[model samples]
Target: MLGAKRETVSRIISQFKKAGIIVHENGNLVVLKMDDLKEKAQ
Candidate 1:
């Protein structure tokens, strides 16, 4: 568990979606740009 609130997680996921870093398909999350995602994580 990341220990983050659900709202916090949801917001971050929404940001990622907006940035085209990830997507939700068939109830699964797919990473579109691993390098970009890693950069964002930093």
Candidate 2:
């Protein structure tokens, strides 16, 4: 895991959402796809 705080995780999730890497639904976070994130991270 990332070993981040709740707020930190929330913030990062929000950023990822903005970048279309993941999505929040029904109070849960789901990774829509990892390709974009992986590609951009490299």
Q: Residue by residue across 1-42, what tens digits does model 2's lDDT show?
A: 334456765677778779977655623434434334445656
The reply for model 1, stretches above 4 Å from the true place, is 30-42
lDDT of each: 0.58, 0.56
* Residue-wise C-alpha lDDT for candidate 1, range 1-42, written one tens digit per residue: 135566776687788788977757622543334435556776
lDDT for residue 40 in candidate 1, whole number 0-100: 72
Against the true structure, what is each candidate's TM-score?
Answer: 0.52, 0.46
